[model samples]
Target chain A: MSQPEILNQAFELGYTYTRSTGPVVGRFLTGLKNRKLVGIKASDGRVIVPPMEYDPDTAEELSEFVDVGEQGEIVTFAWVKEPREAHPMNEPFAWAMIKLDGADVPMIHCVAAKSESDVTTGARVRAVWADETIGFMTDIRCFELV
Target chain B: MSEEEQEMITKVEAPVYLKYNFTAGSAPTRFLAQIKKGVLAGQRCPKCLAVYIPTRGSCGRCGVPTVEEVELSDKATVQSFTIVSIPIPNNPIEPPFIIANVVPDGANVSFIHLMSECVNEEVHIGQRVQAVWKPEDEWGYSMDNIRYFKPLDEPDVPIELIGKLTVTGEEG
Candidate 1:
């Protein structure tokens, strides 16, 4: 008797998991949903954008929330000539460590620019909110040169 | 963060989807070869003497690699089972099916598999069963090669041999 053909099947794997974002992160995501920018004061009174629950160096608790401006300066950036699959944008963009107005510390985010020549270490940029905000880090779709 | 904002922070619901293909490790690679030839291979732990089906690289109890390979008999006993009536998504079988932990002959530990060729109500501890394989060509490098364990129409496995299959059960 002839042998039976090999069996092969592809399956879809999915899971739905809900978790608490905690007070600090929840407040920041809520701010993004409302098209507002917010940061938290670190242990030593240094404003840390994209708030950390505890100060990294001192390990002190952080809770004081401060409203920050949407516009910020690109303290430093890396130009992506060829974007990878996980990159925010398909076209060439720069991943910048931005220091938003009124915040002492810089936060890493992607900045949209025409080319490497258009992006600079001290270039000013502003947050571009998504069309429909759902309280996610991706809510700030991407930053654009101001 | 203010008290009002803390109160407003509710549970965040997010559904994750991912796809991955894993390479079969060395032990699994050899076990797959045996399954392709319609055989169930097991590795025995030198220290604990536990027979691990689909041969594991190391013995959990001994913490040593099993160098000897042994072929296990197709016949096994339904040492334990559960009648799953809940309709869970991604469940291979329909509701009200029996998923059993059957100890193949001469193997110390039991292997979990679906029990076929017997009514859900008839499946019980010590019920003798036999591995029913798919067509030879349909065989693959997975436990799927054995479609299911079916009734053997024989007496229950020996009481002494059945031993303490369950950890919570008294020593046999």
Candidate 2:
């Protein structure tokens, strides 16, 4: 029997594709990567966090970017008793809708808290970004109680 | 593609996580069981009589349920074949390997499998091939039970009869 030629090839069992984030959402997230926050003004003059390209009610095109503050008040939240595998936090935490200093409507994200007893409707929190910030949703690891 | 046209499309990369469950129905359950036991199984349609290797539990032609389970031979006729050369990430096999569709005797539908044993050029569309199974101890509920199909010493079937697996007058 003769030995066959062996070749070294690189392969990975994972997804390989590039997605385009349009100019509007792209700039807003780019701000987060730079440790800065940005918002967009809606047609009725309401500032929106995680900016939208169009006003939902008026169907108006929105582009004016507004710089928002890092600190925000929790509008409403659901406390996790036991975290699911998919949840961002493994320990007891709260998934909250936070109204940042300059935004009109709230943005939804997870909050890191010592206990469920610590979080409340009007509790103040600030963004605690990941050690290495990239233009990713997880770049904001979670908000910590301020 | 021009540089300005390329600039129009911005590319971003991210790792995605997804989870789901597969529900193998009664017919596929039977098929998997046979593979685990080191055998090939198919079901015969009651009306059309066309056999399905991984039985859909119903015949596509008559929409009639297939109930009679039939044992199939490991040997098969190569229906189609292609040699892949371009390297793509996550490909299970390396470049220059053959991916072919082979229909086992008494089975009407063709199933995809890897072809091996002979050098690249000798493989033909009507080639006679037999399943080269993994060691019996390693058999499980997967088509991987048969690692690949190897060329047979017998002559290739006539060109017109090459791809046909269903018996005469039973064509669908």
| B1-172 per-residue lDDT for model 1 (tens digits) | 4654644645577767675565666677677778888988888788887778767788988899986787877888777899999976666678887789987776777888988888888788888888888998898677988888999888776567573332222233
How does each model score on lDDT? 0.81, 0.81
Per-residue accuracy of model 1 over A1-146 as CA lDDT, tens digit each: 24334434455587867888887888888888777888999877789989888987889788899999999999999999999876799999999999999999999999998999999988999999899987887889999999
Candidate 2's C-alpha runs over 4 A off are A1-17, A55-62, B1-16, B20-29, B56-67, B80-89, B96-98, B116-128, B150-172
How displaced is residue A31 in candidate 1, in Å?
Answer: 1.7
Q: Return the lDDT, model 1, position B171.
A: 30
Top of the candidates by TM-score: 2
Q: Encode model 2's per-residue lDDT on B94-143: one tens digit a residue.
A: 87888899888778788999998867777888788899999999997789
Model 1 chain B lowest lDDT segment of ten: B163-172
User: What CAPRI-style quality would you assign to candidate 2?
Assistant: incorrect
Cand. 1 TM to true fold: 0.67
Listed in order, each prediction's TM-score against the native is 0.67, 0.73
